[model samples]
Target: MTHLFSKLSLYNSARYPANAARPLLEIHVLQPRQVFTLAAATALAPVAIDLYLPSSVGMARELGVDAGAAGLAVSVFLFGLAAGQLVIGPLSDRVGRRPTILGGLACFILAAGVASQANSLPVLLTARLFQALGACSVLLSSRAMVSDRLDPPSAARLFSMLSLIGGAAPVLAPIIGALLAELGGWRACFFFMAVFGFTVLTAATVLLPESRSAETSAAARSESPVEAYLTLLKNREFQLYLIAGGANGAAFFTYLGNSASVFQDVYGVSPFAFSIMVALNAGALVWANQINRRLLKQHSLLAVLRMSGRNAGLLAAAFALMALSGVTALPLLLGLVFLMVGSVAPVQANTLASVMGIGRARAGSAGALLGAAIFALGALASSIAGYFYDHTARPLTLVTAVFLAITSLALG
Candidate 1:
């Protein structure tokens, strides 16, 4: 709730630690193919966010529980992701990126295997929690890896590409899950996730180079978890960016958590049809992501933020007005939805680059804290959206509109 913008001046002169440790291999060490592989590894955890969405309804029937409670499993995973990132982010800084990610991937694989075997709702939920914990390494460390090896401008460009892949995965996963479920069953989705995690684990072990520099500055060397957090808390712009980012994430989670019921119970649409809607949003985001890359080349990161933040605000306001006027036609709503989500990747990548750019010596910590905060915000949003599931799309529209308003204010 604190105003992060007020503290912007405090970090204006901040710089990456000149004495920071270096990567074992230079950024120039890897081929383009290897970089893409690493990027894919980093994106898998985000893919997990929506990979299971198409299966939520089927999962409820199989687990003998109501859909809402089964939906809680997704929220639980988010909680784990938030909490795990908090630890892994700081831990990676203390030790190294490789160890933390490898450990997390191992746990993720174990959890997926366990989830695939779960026969009851509670067991399944617990398995998902662990799965999120494991996935955190991939999510958090991937960013840290790039931050460690590349300068801010280069990192921003790389992150844009990473955002593209991460955004695409979630958008496409539902389609995959729906097809697999229609052919196999809900359990098959988890099985596929396990296999995917295994592939990432293998790739990470083979391709991920260590990146903790031995020449880290005094601040980097002396920073404890407490100090890392205290620094972020006291910084105004960081807090503002964090809140905006988290609110945006909550909006996404609102869509994700409630999609099953919204698609099936409300619209009476098949999973495949629902996935097409999701894909449309993702495609819009992909286009937006590419635009951001071009914009970044021509403008400062701040310019991108101002453009995206304002544009998203205007669009979200329009959507809210339409919903308020009871324009509930499916095409109208889907068009609004796609427009709202279009800003997601651009806004997130820019905000993250801005926030982490300020804490060059401790980007891992910055990334971890931000990731956790967004997940917490997302869990809260998911819970609220789930509560208002009246077999209508109104709940999603209302929640997303609220988040957009909050983000607009925060960004301003």
Candidate 2:
């Protein structure tokens, strides 16, 4: 596995000699505007997924769907995310990043409009699927673009910083979603998605530079899709990171998909208050990712990942215990949730850098594969949690704990 990554490093060094990297880094690495583009691109899918969460119950009622059926909308969106990455990843490798992203942005804008006008559950879910598809394209391309310009160490730092910057969306999304739902109704959330999509499209068209080099593009074109994925799949260590990342994603998304329900329905918190609690947890993610960036200066990526994974697993177990104990302590529950959420960036950022570094030859495909693993597993976890909801925190906490336990095993 190390040899595979080493060969890629050597491949990069030959084409972009170390001396060239400084200038390239100056331009493509975390520059202020580029940071915004990348952050927004990465955050789009999450924002789309989360922005309407506060309205899930309302949307269900309006559409005449059961709670479980409404919950399946999120799971379906996750599935679309996974599928889109698999399709567009290889396409981006062939077509270049800029155009692929632009095309996807158009799709997102169109889908968001469609979702806004949805008259039924099936219509809403279908529109959400296309929305996920577009969001996944932008996401995989942003990830691949970083790998295109930087090696693993630099990429790790950039990813952490990027997450910190983009972390703003997660913090604000629910609050904004709640406010929009209150003022204009549930459809307003989807309307906002369209407007936001258009804004990003314009920014990306004007500001985002093409990072995929001609040499890399040719190399990508030379391989068939089957060969490319086979190259990635055959690496043992990559498989470990995939499992670790996927498990971490599962735990986080399960908690994400259901926490609003638990906090609001069980505990009787208002939508605005629930959003504030989510914001605090999101702030923990930003803080923790910055800490991860600092720790990487001294520790190996694998080391930081293992430690975070262990801590997250413990915190998740505690979450389950608290739920089972029937303790209604909001502050204590949110504290554990904050800690559990904090672990996400370190584990995911490191794991992503590792896998992308290993398959840097076809970075677009590599990123897509990792994203697919994360979201596919996320969809599975959300489905299981949704199935056992029981109007309590038990389903969410139990799913989170089980997934994090898997994460610890993979990272350990």
Candidate 3:
């Protein structure tokens, strides 16, 4: 890990000397442990959301609500995540990354604890929203910290690295949730999330370094969030990149909102089997992210985005056709979903790098906007898919295909 960081550091120094003046938390080289810590922090929201997915139906039954209302919990969480990023992103720039993250983690811990005790749909939804809000702080700040430390290309790689680490959350979270739900109940999932949040908070408080210096913090404070956002919005390239990234994210969100119901309720798969299926898709995503990191070494980011966007579109179309044709086989549908969703990493990584590159001085704001856009679109997609649930995967596939088509057009 030390050797890899040195190589990346040397490459960045040679490729972009301007980055030499940037305030990095690590003075010499970034340690692998630091990367893992930051990545884990960023994974909080996804882990929290995914960890409870397998228990959504059970939660609804226990809470005496409809499945749609249960699914609304996921959408509400995404909305909170979007809202939080809008606030936390700029706040991190003004106050520094470390404090912003710790503050967010604290909120997440409290929210998770609240959620564990929730006996009604409204209370559970509210708690999930707060949990998302807290997690977004860590998510946005982690990206900004990477931008603060690395140049555009290296930052892109770091984003891919973070995704690689985060991808595991989907794979493992559901399995854990399944076991807990089976052994204890849906509430046990929330209790586990609370404990996880507390652990991450402690680790971040002790190990995470502050990337934004006092000077940068002061300068960031001088500008209002509105002004910063306005300036970023004026950049056409950034807007394009944001749309492309958001579109791909929307596809993933569509899947997340509908997959559990489609696999478990519609297809009659057991919770354990459903967890394994989800893990398989997440494994594919992780593999694709690793491939994206490798591709970055030999190709331009835009080139990678264009290629990924095209491939994702093709895969989504194939999946849509399969769904519409009444083909409900688990293995076939899962394989198509794997390729289509896995294609997101390259497009997202490059688009984010482009967005942050345009506003190097305000990377936090850029990251916030990017994060907000992704989750906002995600919330929209999830809500639409969940509302139109027809006891099949068609709704999910159709929404995913539309988003993939949009992503392809945006990349072009």
* Per-residue accuracy of model 2 over 1-412 as CA lDDT, tens digit each: 2332354455456656566643233332334676688889888987897788777777888999765566777888899999998899888888888888898899999999999999988898899999999999999898888888777766887788789889998888888998999998889999998999898899888878777866567877898877888899999998998898989988888877777667877788877787788878888889998899889878987788878767866876787788688876778777778888888889889888998899887888888888899899999998898888897777887888888888988887
Measure candidate 2: CA RMSD.
4.5
Clashing residue pairs in candidate 1 are 4-236, 4-237, 4-240, 19-215, 21-213, 21-214, 22-213
TM-score against truth, every candidate? 0.91, 0.92, 0.95
List ranges where model 1 is wrong by over 4 Å: 1-22, 166-168, 215-221
Candidate with more favorable, higher TM-score: 1 or 2: 2
Q: Model 2 residue 303 lDDT?
A: 81
Query: Backbone clashes per model, in order?
Result: 7, 0, 0
Could you tell me the TM-score of candidate 3?
Answer: 0.95
Native-to-model Cα distance after best TM-score fit, residue 308 in candidate 1, in Å: 1.6
Write one digit per residue (lDDT tens) for candidate 3, span 71-104. 8888999999889989987898888888889988
lDDT of 1 by residue, 1-412 (tens): 0121122212222333447543475554555555666667666666676677777888898888877776698789888888988888778777777888788888888888888788998898889898998888777877887776555555676687766655667677878878878877877778888888888788878887787666333455697887887887788988888888888777777777777777677778777787777777778777887788788879987777777678768866876787577666877777777777777777788777767776767877888888998888888888888887776788778888888877777776
**Candidate 3 regions with alpha-carbon error over 4 angstroms:** 12-24, 213-219
Model 1 residue 93 CA deviation in Å: 0.5
- Pick the winner on TM-score between candidates 2 and 3: 3
Query: TM-score: which is higher, 1 or 3?
Result: 3
Tell me model 3's lDDT, rounded to 2 decimals.
0.84
